[model samples]
Target: MFSGNGHGKLVGSTQVDELGVLESPVVLTATLSVFRAADALLSWLMERRPDGVSFNPLVGETNDGHLSDIRRRPITEDHVLAAVAQASDGPPAEGCVGAGAGTTALGFKAGIGTSSRTVRTAGRTGTVGALVQSNFGGVLTVLGVPMPADELVPAADRTEPPGNSCMIVVATDLPVDARQLGRLARRAVFAMARVGASFSSTSGDYAIAFTTSDQPPIPDGEIDPVFAAVLDAVEEALLNSLFTAVTTTGVGGRTSHAVPHRAVIERLTAAGRLPAPPLIPESPSETRLRTTPARDEPGS
Candidate 1:
């Protein structure tokens, strides 16, 4: 786990830092509901554990008070358990879901975003995946190009305070130990700056990386590709969070608007950063002819 700023509560981080292992599924929730969520996670884990054993429930959080009734502590044991039970493999739903439902970032409605990249090193192929709950403040930048001032949200609409927090979770299929994972986590946190994270004093910026591979840890010399993958995947994930979120009306009628996609595309295209759209097939027959696979002759 790498923490760029420690302004928010993150339960079980000290243990993960010391022992370099996460023994439970991570539970993410609002700031005030963190303890309750942790307790629920612990209860759910205990039901299946052997007697006389200790466990640590890994729960992380970001404040969502601006958009939700956070002080009410809406998260409950059932909510945590349902999340654990419904977890499955494959692409996860992103943007305005789960822990990110009430979050915002870079003056736009932000939420859960995820992305993955493939890496090859030491004659072995691996994958790196990142999922981020983006809720921070900064000027939005894309592909090193800043969005135009006129494209930004009007000043009157920017009601949310300057800083909140972002929680990044990185997973990999590579053979790496906790030490290496920590390095990967650091790269994830660093990638935040690529998309214009302020890293403010009041913001909690953290990344927790873990590997699922059972093989022995790879040598540090072969870790460079994995590090590069982390940067690319995380940067894209942050952008995805903003791109996929929809405008949301929150507590006291406060609103966070979604980033303007069409205008952004136009800006990037004008800046020569985005390519023009490819020409479409003229008709269905032409499209079929182009897409159809070739068949083998009778005897070849």
Candidate 2:
């Protein structure tokens, strides 16, 4: 795990930091409900383990009070259980869902976002994926292009929260130990700057990275490609969060407007940064297959 700022709560982080292992699925929720979420997660994990064996419940959180009735502590144990039971292996739904339902970021309605990238190193190839709860403040930028200063957001729909935070989870199918995962996690946090994250004093910018491979750990010398892949995937995921989230109104009628997609496209196009649309649209599966490096590539 890597923390750019330590202002926010991340239950189980101390354990993970000391042991370099996460034995439980991560639960993310509103800041005020983190303890409840942790307790619920602990309960769920304990039911599967023998009695008297304590477990650390990995729960992370961001303040969503600006757009939700956080004082109400709306999240319940049932919600956590339901999420666990409904977890899927396929692509996850992103934007304004799950723990990100009432979150805002970069002056826009932001939420859950996900992305993945393939890497080839030495004679092996693997994939790195990132999921982000993007609720941090910054001057919004996409692909190194800053949003136009003249672009006006209505005062009533602005997100002027007192503070912000972001949580990032990274997963890979490469063989790497906790030390390597820690490096990858740091890279993930660094990528936030690519999309204009401020990493403010009041922001909790944390990343947790883990791998699913059981093979021999990759040599540290060959880990560069994987690190590069993390940067790309995380930057894309942050942008995805901003682009896909819809406008939302929450507590006291405070509102957060969605990114102005058309204007952003126009700005990028005018800057000659927008790629032309493909003549032949590819299916999602085909695109995935094409982007992924072959497992048995000649060098790999």
Best by lDDT: 1
Give one digit per residue, the lDDT tens place, for model 1 in 1-300. Answer: 999999998999999999998889988888988999999989987897868378889999888777877766767788889889999997988877788888889888888999999999977898999999999988889988886323555642667877999999999999999999999999999999999888999999989999999899889999999999999999999999888777776666776777777667666787899886463222111111011112331100
TM-score of 1: 0.90
| CA deviation > 4 Å runs, candidate 1 | 148-150, 278-300
Candidate 2: Cα lDDT at 256: 71
Residue-level error in angstroms, candidate 2, position 254: 1.0
TM-score of every model? 0.90, 0.89
Error of 1 at 141 (Å): 0.7
Model 1 RMSD in Å is: 11.5
lDDT of each: 0.83, 0.81
